[model samples]
Target: MNMNMNMNRKQGQILSERFEVAFNQVHDALRDIVQINDDRFVVLVKVGAKKYQIIETYKKDLEQYARLRNAIVHEKMEIGFYIAEPNAKVVSHIEKIANVFSRPNYALSIATKNVVYFDYRDSILKVTAAIKEHGYSKFPIYKNKKCVGLLTSSSIVKWMAQNMENSSVNLSDSHVSDIMTYEKEHPIEIVAKDINIFEVENIFEKAHRKKQKIEGVIITEHGRADESPLGMITAWDLIQIDYTVD
Candidate 1:
């Protein structure tokens, strides 16, 4: 038996049903991600917003949808009626938001693919050349087919500063291993490609809170340094996308 007869449903009622379903879906999804749930939709989103860029980015809209949802409840609530139907445009928008939180984008999807990295034994000049040619600031250094560390413009600068005898630094004489000494320990975090973007963003946010700078995040097959990188996420990439980060 078709429980909802199309002919008996008002256009406002149809939009209301859709809008409420999507609105509740967004609530349920955020509730799952929130650390401390107060059993309130806006509160869950607010707490989640502090950590997940997806929630933070759409914070205002979610809050407003919460208000709009209540306003649409008809005097005769149990009849699936509405005092005012959500605009078709707004209902579609909420449905998309619900889908986003439910589906969840992965780190690999937004990361910089085909990362430009180096070997620990590779020449520093080679790194500089790649930097000049590509304007990339970070590169992962590998050894024995396993990543050893990440090289950044800062580390390269520190290497040059220490290696200079007079005014000239011998890039031709130095290798990536020589520069690796200048990089701080735990320069980057390796994560799996399957990790959700929210988790990826939270990693950066947590590092920021600790006042530790992570040069970049490497997304690999199994979240291990030994695994080759599928993609990389740097702070600049987050900034470009307006994702919250240090």
Candidate 2:
């Protein structure tokens, strides 16, 4: 009996080791499948020819599931052992997020995707032209596709006038990289799709009292920032939207 007991212990150890090896292999594959695009809190996962955007924060849960999958694949573990469902709130949240990204117009908003941007390497004249055409006073500057800072029309005018006396004012040569705001993690406020707009207003009001003021509450489904902007209730945009309605 003692010998048999020792045999079971050895088997369990071997199973654990095998599970780890397989887990690593699957982990690598899954990592490749799910990419974290930090520019927006979105995950781009390629499912065949299509790429689906998921919230980057979901990686924690996905990784957990992947490990469970690995254990099940190699250790003959019961599927139930590895398939723990997330808490109700988390599950509900994920559903909302997935819904937001799935919307058709979600990609259109400049806030959602990486829109066309100008860089310092380009001539100041070229930057000016884009601003003129796009009708934006402020342009986010980039260096090697990474945001460096923001350049406003005021800054450009001031710089140009200050250096107007110098014929060698080659703005292109002076990269905008120096004044750009580098990408930093920001906490995005979120709201559920089913929640009424009035509740969102309340959430914003309460948020204003907090130290970190909420930028805009993102409406989500499946806990993902998926579908259309259910409508961002920004303090600035709200005033314009409400007051200007004819």
Candidate 3:
């Protein structure tokens, strides 16, 4: 019985040490991302509450763990054992959080690449065929070699509703510009290839609060619309990775 108690104590102490290490790593990662000149706890709170989507989800839990870490480090040791040793659960949580920050998933990593787009003059029939063939709901519309707007499934549906006659719309006669009018309300956001997935998720959240639904995020070389889009990220893309941790 005594031996078991000693072993448990040792395990707890190890976990406590590991938790501290993980906490420091998280702090450093947030510091780099947020560029805050404050204490570790302040930085953690700021990043947890506003910076990253994954971290923001666990903001309260992280703050609680931060307090526990402070207690573990500041409290006096009792007979070579930490007075407050972090349990396995806390240790695991901290490790997972640190791992996410250490090697974060970027927007470009998950975005759909080699995108198929349409020119402003392209026939609506061609666009419809591409949509049917590829199961793509959103398409970037270009004009003079620059992206002018996005043609989405919603815009197409709205257009069809407005123009349909006896369940038939003139697809060949209609042009991409005809549908562009419907897309004016659903604007596309652009982000750099290096933007983290968490930031991308936050962008969607902010847009939602503003009641402005962003159609999609165009991933460009330097986040400039003039640059060719390397990839695309939608709300669905963020949903796939929101709660998943590597």
Candidate 4:
């Protein structure tokens, strides 16, 4: 009840208009996302919140906005009167959320840039040197300019254990391919440059449900092994991202 008897109706009307537009934007985004058209706005929020981290993040605020929208649209008020006018701050907040729901943050934004990689013919000594210099334990291994597989520190350790002699492994003679033998599992997924973070989050969740672990995500121009990588993302990166807040 923002009943300001002396409040400027012109200003309140403008704010109300903005609030309604933002409200509809959120509703439409949720409806399209959840593929539900017959339900109410609150119901859309309820369903969308379950599938989308962005929706879950602002579920409470959206529910409250649904109530306010009902009052603003249905509640009778005199000309230029506002019985349920949202403040500028609330309007701005909703607008920001609407924008986020409509166009999500890109996965490439959170990926590790300047992806340090390796060729199949490269020596293991070179891999060790690069790891020491960049501290990047996981690398995208390539063959003929196309990604063949992912090479992680864990796989490297396994390779070393199997080939060790007198507690020392020979890195000087082995090629990156030697380590790739230990990395038989393709634990990484390739994503397109325009892929959204929320969808990437779902991919990880789906893998977890199947009792599979995804080592990392490689971002490329076309989400294919043949395409050059743009960046990389790991579980650690996902942990650092609070989609609810970020």
Best by lDDT: 4
Better of 2 and 4 by TM-score: 4
Cα lDDT over the full model 2: 0.44
The residue pairs found clashing in candidate 1 are none
Tell me the number of clashing residue pairs for each predicted model. Answer: 0, 29, 0, 0
Better of 1 and 2 by lDDT: 1
Clashes of 3: 0
Candidate 2, 105-212: lDDT as tens digits: 331131322223576677666666777776655454546644434466676666665655556565656544433323232334555556543344445555655756
- The lDDT values for all models are 0.82, 0.44, 0.80, 0.84
Q: Report residue 152 deviation for candidate 2 (angstroms).
A: 1.4
Per-candidate TM vs. native? 0.87, 0.32, 0.75, 0.81
A best-first ranking of the candidates according to their lDDT comes to 4, 1, 3, 2
Clash pairs (backbone) in predicted model 3 = none
* Candidate 3 lDDT, 37-57, residue by residue in tens: 675776657655674556666
- Scored by TM-score, the top model is 1
Q: What is candidate 4's lDDT per residue for 32-144, written digit by digit as tens? A: 76676566888888876776566777899998898888888888478668688888888998898889888888999888999999999998888888889999888898999
lDDT of 2 at 221: 53
- Output the lDDT of residue 179, model 2: 30
Question: In candidate 4, where is summed lDDT lowest over 10 consecutive residues?
Answer: 1-10
Q: Report the error of model 1 at residue 154, Å.
A: 1.2
